[model samples]
Target: GESVGLHLPTLSVQEGDNSIINCAYSNSASDYFIWYKQESGKGPQFIIDIRSNMDKRQGQRVTVLLNKTVKHLSLQIAATQPGDSAVYFCAENMRGAGSYQLTFGKGTKLSVIP
Candidate 1:
């Protein structure tokens, strides 16, 4: 398990193939998790999300898995597309004192080759 706050900054996948992106979080107290995709010069867009209580969650063509044991998180794309090329980020929603804040990882750039 690794963090967007750590590890390599890029990942490359072939178009039409499945892609698996990984993220490692630092806060064990984090209860909520989200995946964001950011294209060049654009804001990060929500891709998917999972709660600490859930081990897995699925979306249209994406899936998110959480391993609380090792504090690891991953995103699985069913069909990697050129449009999917972007910087992927993992963020955590931490709560304390009756309030919550967001913490984001570095980001992994996904390059889709046709």
Candidate 2:
């Protein structure tokens, strides 16, 4: 799905440098989360995921950290490359309320400066 916004906050990182993207969520009942990378004209692709029982999880060059107390989520990219340039979004799985619901945060566009 597309990151819904006309103007999104952007984070620019130098090539080969590490990048950190942050997100804040309101629902405390959320249990699962996933980070997706979306390139222009394409749908978002899964990068990594973390569960509420876990504080952090790693996959390939990406790491996802969750702080339930602060209801904050972060995605860390190691050794950023040109291919990593894209809009990143965090999705939360909201359990209960009769059925499962997934909420998406405003995306951050990461630009790798070569």
Candidate 3:
């Protein structure tokens, strides 16, 4: 089955350091990708997104990169902070017959060590 998965299940970063999370998707047809952050007891919040037509997109303190050639995606965080500790997920949106189907990755837990 087509799915999205992360290269690592957990990532630990020291405070003020930079962190990178990698994800791989099986569906090459997916045209849209999104990165989400989920804090404890909270729902996933949108972080950044990238379209297949482009290779990269940047947000406030984060950047998302897409490599359609290998069906790979990545999220980078600058100056990691305690508040940045959360479960990060990558989602791929594929267009179906009449609607879009969203598939989420298993998620990578980001631990910020102070």
TM-score, prediction 3: 0.91
Q: What is the lDDT of residue 47 in candidate 3?
A: 94
lDDT for model 3 comes to 0.89
Which has the better TM-score: candidate 1, or candidate 3? 3
Best by TM-score: 2
lDDT of each: 0.89, 0.92, 0.89
Question: What's the TM-score of each model vs. the native?
Answer: 0.90, 0.93, 0.91
How large is the C-alpha RMSD of every model relative to the true structure? 4.5, 2.2, 5.0
Tens-place lDDT digits, model 1, residues 1-114: 223333547788889999999999998999999999987767889999999999999999999999999999999998898999888989998887888788998888888999
Clashes of each: 3, 0, 0
> Tens-digit lDDT track for model 3 on 1-114?
222334648899999999999999979989999999988778889999888999999899899989898999999999999999988989999777879878998999898999
Ranking by TM-score: 2, 3, 1
Per-residue error (Å), model 3, residue 47: 0.5
- What are the per-residue Cα lDDT tens digits for candidate 2 across 1-114? 454456899999999999999999878989899999999878889998899999999989989999999999999999999999999999999887689877899899999999
